[model samples]
Target: MAEKNYYDILGVKKDASDADIKKRYRKLVRQFHPDVSDDPDADNKIAEINNAYETIRDKDKRAEYDAMLDNPFASQGGAGGFGGQSAGGQSGFRWEDMKDQFGDGEAFGGGGFRFDDIFSAFGRGARGSAGAQSSGTSGGFDQFGGGFGAQDSKGQDQHAEISVDLASVYSGDDYSIKLNVPVRKPNGSVDYENKTLKIKIPKGITDGKQIRLAGQGAAGHGGGKNGDLFLKVKITHSDNIRLEGADVYQTLNIAPWEAALGDKVNVTTPTGTLGVSIPKNSKSGSNLRLKGKGIPAKHTGDLYLTLNIVNPEVNTDEAKQAYEQLKQAFADTSIHR
Candidate 1:
């Protein structure tokens, strides 16, 4: 079978301009983005799109790829292919040299845009597999996608992102994930099996930190050890909360009188509910720092309460009169200098 064409994958013509290519790429990405797409193969489609765009988007790489397409036999030697002799009865090319170029899946850079970036853009995490191969040519399929040869080699490691709730980070919790993993059959054939594994989220685990699972990645060949799986943690929080390292900032709503006169109010925090005092004459957007009340790490972190004053509606006559009286009281106070 012929190799997949990059242009066909991106739905673009060979003579298409850069702008056209970029526009097509964006359209395809939106159509196949896992978050919104209903396609079952959206994940694989995205990987193919990213790989094709990364190559064709670059001028130098595109030129090199075009040359290869124009002369398909140049790299494999004129007429001489992998088997034994050339099509023009010349000679067989060196299999070792071809293996050096395409084997081990490093030739194409393993998909430039990683899966983590795709899912992170949607404010979530993703689980998927790529280039997962088994040891040996079990099912008559070689590790390099050809029927040429087989050898004992360790499988490649896999990476994915996992979303962890802020509450879960405050207190460690257990989570489970399902994946389609390679299972090496006793007959030496490789089979993809759905498996579930439970993961532990440690307390105070920050975003971008990875958790490694041994022997949970692609299966190895010829008694080689299986590759490990790495899960990068992404800490997720509500819109009202923002985190800066170990410090947590949350919006605290208070009344107008509470801001003018000191008052105590209860706040429901990640740790628990606590009564906090609203300082007298406090303004909106003021931060109240509670030391060592953020994430419960070794050093601990601080929690900041940003005050947001909200006013009650003055629809009732009594309410309107009260507001009028208050307005008269503060009429002489200059808000702006």
Candidate 2:
């Protein structure tokens, strides 16, 4: 077997740039990955793809390979030709003969051509045996091709975090978040691209909890399905409220009189304003619990309101006089208590 045309095996031209070759190589990998593909020749096809990519992935080696492609007698020593030591005076090089330089399952880079690299473009970096999803990122991009047959193995799952406002979490509405996505460049380097993906946020989602959106993650090659997308919910700080385990905590400020004489005060919450009644003789640090008003969830959360009494300034003579009279009314022991 004479040296197979690396370019032709990858379905590209000899003059094709590394970028062009990589583009074709990935497409072919998707179609022929043994774990996903049932093609009888998938393994052989992928091996060839890996072999071709290995030779060309390296700049110097590709140059030498290119020279040989142009003229079989180009290399120094005309070493055994490419196909192997010509027996019976048979001449010329074949790529398969070069396999001797490296063992099976390894590429020219001292590494194996991994399905991970290919799937990384689709956003999954790790996979379980037989292509089952182990772990990965949210999304990815690459330079390449069309469709493929269904995968024999399932697609890998992807993970990401999206920050959501407290109000949005309270309402459990659909949220759109931006991701600074890492993409594989034509030269096989990494670069970033901003992607805006719309994923449904589950109602009553809590902070630090992950929401799984199926089939919205890393895309699958061939007939394989895209992996699942897991968005970890990160609740942003609210101007007036703090959240904890689905509970909403807020501090309510009331006038001294309101605390002493009991008052119906209107309080504002993320949902809306409500008139809450304060009990007579209510002191600071007192908490008022509103049932089922915290986060909207299956278990339901409660809103806890803590009251703080604010005193009127004694800047005016009349205010000072009023304070004196109020102070005197309460005996020393009562005041101390």
Candidate 3:
């Protein structure tokens, strides 16, 4: 069989840009993640996406994989992989004929199976002078080119990115997430198992920080402890709010008169709406600070309101006359400061 195409798995073309690939990958992760999704195949789907992403995300790895995709013998294990034995049959030893001769535990000791045993059994010499590379019982390939099963080996830790909106960060609530894990079959094949977990998102959490779940990663080979799952938080922000650490900034638009004469106005904050006083003769771009009003945590953050003065349109004659008078009054005034 041909090796799977990483690009196709992510629903992207070979020419897709890095940004485009990231967009698609994020969408798929959210779709198949077991903690939040209801689909039974979500775990397998996500695992596929993760594998594709890890392979194609690197420039050198992608180039190497692309070259392999064009090669005829790429899947047959290249030079070292058994690749199902159809290629090695030209020398009178058909790989298909050995189906009844070898079993997993029949040839090798308790460590693991080796492909070299097959070559030795047939007296055709080993696959290579180096012999079959043993992966201990933990992870190396078998002599017949089979892959490692769980074998009680500790599962590997898995990583994923989770995107959260600003509201969730402010609330610091517990969230449920879903994921699919790989389960090794008796025949050495692997299958996906979906799982969901309730996790707590730390309040005042910043982007790029990670939260860890114990025993939530890939299953161990046999009775080995499951690996941990680490989630890197990606906080998605909107144009309406700018968040930095505990500091929150928002641009507040106000009438010109309000800035010149001053007034108490209600301002919306991450916590809630609060009435704040605008100082008299305030200029546009003035900052109104509300201490300890941004995010609620051990160390509270402040909210900074940037004032933007807006002049009303002079469409009516009365408004035009008022503007003309104001212009005349200030025309000779030395307000250059």
Q: Which candidate has the highest lDDT of all? A: 1
Q: After superposition, how far is residue 82 of candidate 3 from its true place, in Å?
A: 20
CA lDDT of each candidate?
0.67, 0.61, 0.64
Which lDDT tens digits does candidate 2 get at residues 93-193? 22233344444425567676743354455543333211212231111221221111111112445688888877787676777877664333232222346
Per-model TM against the reference = 0.56, 0.51, 0.53
lDDT by residue for model 1 (35-83), tens: 6789987766765565466566767657755764566443343112212
lDDT of 3 by residue, 99-153 (tens): 3355442444545555556455534343432222232221123332222121334
What is the model-wide C-alpha lDDT for candidate 3?
0.64
* Candidate with the larger lDDT of 2 and 3: 3
Steric clash pairs (candidate 1): 79-86, 79-87, 80-86, 135-221
* TM-score of candidate 3 versus the correct structure, residues matched by position: 0.53
In terms of lDDT, the poorest run of 10 residues in model 2 is 142-151
The per-prediction CA RMSD against the true structure, in angstroms, equals: 14.6, 16.0, 11.4
Error of model 1, residue 247, in angstroms: 1.4
What's the CA RMSD of model 1 in angstroms?
14.6
lDDT of 1: 0.67
Worst 10 residues of 3 by lDDT: 78-87
Please give the TM-score that candidate 1 achieves against the real structure: 0.56
